[model samples]
Target: MEAKSERAERAAQNELLFRAVNEQILQMTERFRAQLSDIDIVCECAVASCVGTIRITAEEFVRIRRETGTFFVLAGHEDTDVEDVVGRRNGYVVVRKQAVAADA
Candidate 1:
């Protein structure tokens, strides 16, 4: 079995990667002066090979980014083994990693 700390680390890493991708996308779209409506965001799941994308409003993305422990994931992509589902939207879900993962 994987150690709790290891799982947490993995989950944190996955979230970090997802956030990096989202930040890049944001920068690319910033110049367009796009309205704060629907935007495409990478899935913030604990799977290294995942390439899924979820659509979320820019305002929603900003809200999720404000919380360090919370991540926006595609529907059904949440890893319940490492995180808890905190909110569900029409096309995405918000997950908060366990405290150990959050600390990492």
Candidate 2:
């Protein structure tokens, strides 16, 4: 019973962290929308932790790359074709950074 309670507490904490980060990303997207009129931005949040994926126009991608110092990894490089519509080339997924202390 104690173990179950502990697990539930951890889940709740993770959920709150996820929500906080998701809101931050939404705010950032809104800012992007206001500055650049050419491209569109879409954000996708993960149910677990601070992980998320964002889709932005290719032009937006370039702008974000220039603005932020964050690093990104290439995904969807398998049998799936990465090149498709706006979400494919122009947009990117935004993942939240997790603190080392939180991992414990």
Give the alpha carbon lDDT tens digit for every residue of 1-104 in model 1.
Answer: 99987987997898889889998887777766465467798898888888989987777788778877888888888888788898999878999887845686
**Candidate 2: worst-modelled 10 consecutive residues by lDDT:** 77-86
Question: Candidate 1, clashing residue pairs?
Answer: none
- So what's the TM-score on candidate 2? 0.33
Number of the predicted model whose lDDT against the real structure is largest: 1
lDDT of 2 by residue, 4-99 (tens): 545544544553454455446545666676665443322322224234444444454555444221222124311111111122333343332233
Model 1 C-alpha lDDT versus the unseen true structure: 0.83
Candidate 1, residue 18: Cα displacement in angstroms equals 1.1
How much is the lDDT of residue 35 in candidate 1?
57
Cα deviation of 3 in candidate 1 (Å)?
Answer: 1.7
Worst 10 residues of 1 by lDDT: 29-38
Q: For candidate 2, what is the lDDT?
A: 0.37
Q: Which candidate is the best by TM-score?
A: 1
